[model samples]
Target: MFVLNTFDIGECLSFLCFISVSLIFCFFMLFASSVLGGKSLSRYKHTPFESGIDPVGDTSLHFSIKFYLVAMFFVIFDVESLYLYVWSVSIIETAWKGFIEAFIFILFLLLSLFYLIRIKALNWVHK
Candidate 1:
C-alpha cells in the first residue's frame, strides 16, 4: 500500500500550487499581451535606437589585444580573490591543512603573475 505522511502531502500540495499559479500567471500575461499589444509597420521602429543617437561608423571595430589580455587578467585575479576569501572565512576550522593549501595556491598565482610581467604580457605601449 502507498502511504504519504502529512509533511509529504503538504509539500506535494505546495509544489502543485506553485506550478499551477506560475502557469496561470504566464498564460494570463500571454493573453493580456495578445489582447492589448499593437502592431507597428514603421521603418524606423525596426532599426536599433541608442538613446536617440544615430549609430555611425563600422559596427565591427578591431580592438587591441591589450584590452583582451587585461580583461583576462582581471577575471583570473578576481576568481583567485574569491577563493582566498572563502579560505580566509573557514581558516579557523580548516587550520594548518587549509593554510598550507592556500599558501600553495597563492604561490602559484604569484609565480604566474611574475611570469606574465617578465614576458611583458601586461605592457600596452610595447604592442
Candidate 2:
C-alpha cells in the first residue's frame, strides 16, 4: 500500500473524507444497535414513579417557558467558556488575528446576553 503525504491536496481531501465517513459510520452503527436491541419497550416503562409509590394522574403537565429559557442560557454560558479556553491558547501564537477572532466570538455570544437583558431574564423582582 503506497501512502500519500498530506501536503498533496488529494491526500488532504482523502483524510477529511476518511474522518467524515468514520464518524457517520460510527453514528449509524450505534443507532442500529440501540434500535435492534429493543430491550425496554414494555408497558411498565411508560409509568412514572415517586419514591417507589404508584404513579399519579396528569403526568403531561405544561411548564413555564422561562424554565427552558434558563436552561438554554446556562448551556450557552458553559459552551462560551469552552471557546474562551481555546482562544486563550491561540492568542499566544497568532497575536492580532487570534485576538480579533476571539473578539468576534465574544461579540456573537454578547448577543445572547443582550437578549437575556431585554427579557429581564436575570431579574428576580416579582411581576
Candidate 3:
C-alpha cells in the first residue's frame, strides 16, 4: 500500500475541511433565504429593464456581419497577447531562440492585420 506523507495527508484533510465548510455555508444560506425572504410579485418588477429604458422596438434586429468579424478579431488578438505575455515572462530563459520565435509570431499577427485592412474587414461602413 502506498502511504501518504504527513504533508500530503494534511493537504487532503485541509481540502476536505474546505469543501465541508463550503457545503455547510451554502446549505445555511439556502435555508435562511427560503425562511426569511419576501414573496412579493409586482407587474413593474416582472418587466425587463434595460439601463432604465423601457422595451421600445422589436427585440430581434438583424446584426451586421462586420460586428461578428470585429469580435472574432478581438478574441484572436486577445489570445495572442496572452501568449506574448507568457513568452515575455520567461524571456530570459528562452533567450535568442524565443526572441526569433516571438518576432515570427508578431510578423504573422501584423500580416493578418494588414490582410484584414486590405479586405476592409475592419471597416464599419461598406462601400
TM-score for every candidate vs. truth? 0.68, 0.54, 0.61
Give all candidate RMSDs, comma-separated: 6.3, 6.4, 5.4
Give the lowest summed-lDDT range of ten residues in model 2. Answer: 1-10
* CA error at residue 108 for candidate 3, angstroms: 3.2
Sort every candidate by TM-score, greatest first: 1, 3, 2
lDDT per residue for candidate 3 within 1-127, as digits (tens), equals 4665546778789999999999999999999999999888888978779999899988788988888988999999999999999999999999999999999999999999999999888889867
Provide the lowest-lDDT 10-residue window in model 3: 1-10
Regions of candidate 1 where Cα sits further than 4 Å from its true position: 1-36
Q: How much is 10 displaced in model 3, in angstroms?
A: 3.9
Positional deviation of 21 in candidate 3, in angstroms? 4.2
Poorly placed runs, candidate 2 (over 4 Å): 1-52, 121-126
Cα lDDT of model 2 overall? 0.84
Clashing pairs in 1: none
Judged by TM-score relative to the true structure, which candidate is superior, 1 or 2? 1
Query: Looking at model 2, how many pairs of residues clash?
Result: 0
Could you tell me how far off, in angstroms, the CA of residue 30 lies in candidate 1 after the best superposition?
Answer: 7.2
Report the lDDT tens digits of candidate 2 across residue range 1-98.
46765468897799999999999999999999988976867887977768899976777889878788778889979988998998887776879988
Q: Which whole-number lDDT from 0 to 100 does residue 49 have in model 2?
A: 63
- What's the C-alpha lDDT at position 94 in model 3? 96
